[model samples]
Target: MEFMEVIRKRRSIRKFKPEPVPDELIMELLEAARLAPSGTNLQPWRFIIIKSEEKRRELLGHTVNFVVTAPVVIACCVDLNTYKQHKPQRIKELTRAGAFSGVDLNFNDGDKYWKQRGALNANEIREYVSINCAVAVQQLVLRATDLGLGTCWVMMFDQDSVKKILGLGADIDVLALIPVGYADQDPAPRPRLPVRELLIKELK
Candidate 1:
């Protein structure tokens, strides 16, 4: 499918068919995520493919809607350690490579921003990493749509329960949950803000 067409037709599918999604298709979706652009190419994302019935059930129990019936659930995680200590090195390398030629790459006190978002210390870094992981999730959604698959991004869940269920590493934080399968119903597009209302152009 064309890229624009995929973007236009993609919907948040709530109901899914019972048939299972193939492993190859799942890998294709993951490959799409792998190709996503990350800050400094850190690529801190990790995906946990949940296909086992028991695990799926546990996940469903934690989430309120839109995941139990889907054949595949991909849990997106971010490793805080991926960027914790590499900022200085990354800045130096980018500067040497001319990647920061037109940009202000200096972030002397990066933690200051995170602190404002309620990220206190090292533990909060994991939460900050999860925000990056969400970018990969968006890529997965778009790619899945291109593949003629239905997907729903679910987040209304017990994060701690999900982390325990998935047995993720201490430094890993769950960013988003995606359920993929064939759609049972064609949902109408939800209302969106008009471009004129959303965009602000500053004329100098």
Candidate 2:
């Protein structure tokens, strides 16, 4: 399918058919997410594919009931440890590859730079992880649309409880829950603000 068509057709599918999503297609969706861009190429995303009825039932308390209707529920998580461990290595790699060409890369002052800090503070880590994880999830959603599958990016959930249910470690945090399958209903296009209202300013 064409890119724009996929974008137009993609919906937050709450209802799904009984047919299961093929394992190969599921992998393709994950592949798209795996290749998403991240800050400093830290690539902190980790996915837990929940398919069993029993496991989905466990997540029901933390998430919406509609999530379990889909054949697959992917628990998207961010590894704080990965971000902490990989920044320096990724920076060095980029420096070697001229990614920061003609730019001064400094680590002399720990106070002034995030790279120099031993680790990001809790809020900083959450914000950074959220942005990167959202990108990956978006890619997964778009790819699912292209494959004639359906998906929903579910964020209205009890994050801490869901994390515990998924058996995530201290270094890992659940970012979003995505339910995927074949759609049972065709939803109308949602309302969008006009372009004029969206544009804040245009500098000459």
Candidate 3:
């Protein structure tokens, strides 16, 4: 499918059919996410694919019961260490890969970075992980849509409860719970703000 069409066709589907999504297709979806770009190419995201009926029931407990009806649920996560704990290593690797163009040290990891890190109290780590993981999540979502699958990126849930349910450690955090499967219903697209209103004029 065309890229723009895929983006336009993608929707947040809440209801899904009982049919099961093939394991291969699921793997392909993850592959798309794996190819997403990340800060210093650290690739700090991990995923949990929930497909078993019993586990799905457990997941339903974390969010609204209705969403778990999908054949699969992916727990998108980010490793906190991807930034704070491994900044130097990632920067070194990025330089080797010719990705860390010094345009960013003086562009990669410089005195200003360490100073900002000290000032931010490590919050910069969250910022990096969040952006990287979000990019990956969107990649997965778009790939799933391209495969004729429906997905709902769920965020409004008890994060702590979900962590406990999945036995996740503090080192990782869930960004979204994407329920993927065949759409049970296809409603009209929701309203969107006008492009002119959303796009602002460039500053001279």
Candidate 4:
């Protein structure tokens, strides 16, 4: 499928068929996520593919809105250790290098930034790492759409429950849960803000 077509046609699929998704296609979707760009190319994302019915049911119980009818649920995780724990020195270097050029790094009189930097606990860093994982998640969703598969991005779940469900180490953080499979219903396009309302153009 064409890129634009995939983007336009992609919808948040809530209903799915019971048909099984092949391992090769799942790998392809993972590959798309693997290739997504990351801050400093850190690539901190990890995916846990859940296919067992019991585990899927348990996951659904945690996030009732999650589309577990799909054959697969991919739990996206972010590894905080992957990027040296977001130190102030590194942030200074990144700022000096213009790594965040055209972006604002300030956060509430700098307290928010320092608070994030000082995050030594898993919960604190989990929020930080989840931001990076979101980029990879977008890639996965788009690639799944291109592959003629449907997907739903689920976030309303008990984090601890998910951690226990996947038996993930305390160091790893779950960012998002995505269920992928063949669609059972064709959903209409969701409305979006008009470009005129959403975009602000500055003509020089």
> lDDT per residue, candidate 1, 1-204, as tens digits?
998999999999989999899999999999999988777666789999998877888876689656877888998888778875665566466657766454333343333323444423775566556666788888999999999899988888888999999997677778888999999989999899999997799588
Model 2, 1-204: lDDT tens digits are 999999999988999997999999999999999999998888888999999989999987788999988989999889887666887787777667766655344442222355455567888987898799899989999999999999999998998889888988788888889999999999998998999999999999
TM-score to true structure, per model: 0.85, 0.92, 0.89, 0.80
Candidate 2 Cα errors over 4 Å, as ranges:
104-119
For model 4, residues 1-204, the per-residue Cα lDDT tens digits are: 988999998999988889999999999999999998765466789999999878788876788554567789999888878756545556576667766555355442233465665645665556656777898999999999999999988888888988998898867878888999998889899889998997688688
| Winning model by lDDT | 2
Off by over 4 Å in 1: 85-89, 102-124
CA lDDT, every prediction? 0.81, 0.87, 0.84, 0.81
Alpha-carbon lDDT of model 4: 0.81
Give the true-structure RMSD of model 1: 4.0
Evaluate model 3: give its lDDT: 0.84
Q: What's the CA error at residue 149 for candidate 4, in Å?
A: 0.2
Among all candidates shown, the one with the greatest TM-score: 2
Q: Who is ahead in TM-score, 3 or 4? A: 3
lDDT of 3 by residue, 6-120 (tens): 9999999999999999999999999999999986677889999998888888876679776689989998998987776677776666667765346554545454455565634
What are the clashing pairs of model 1? none
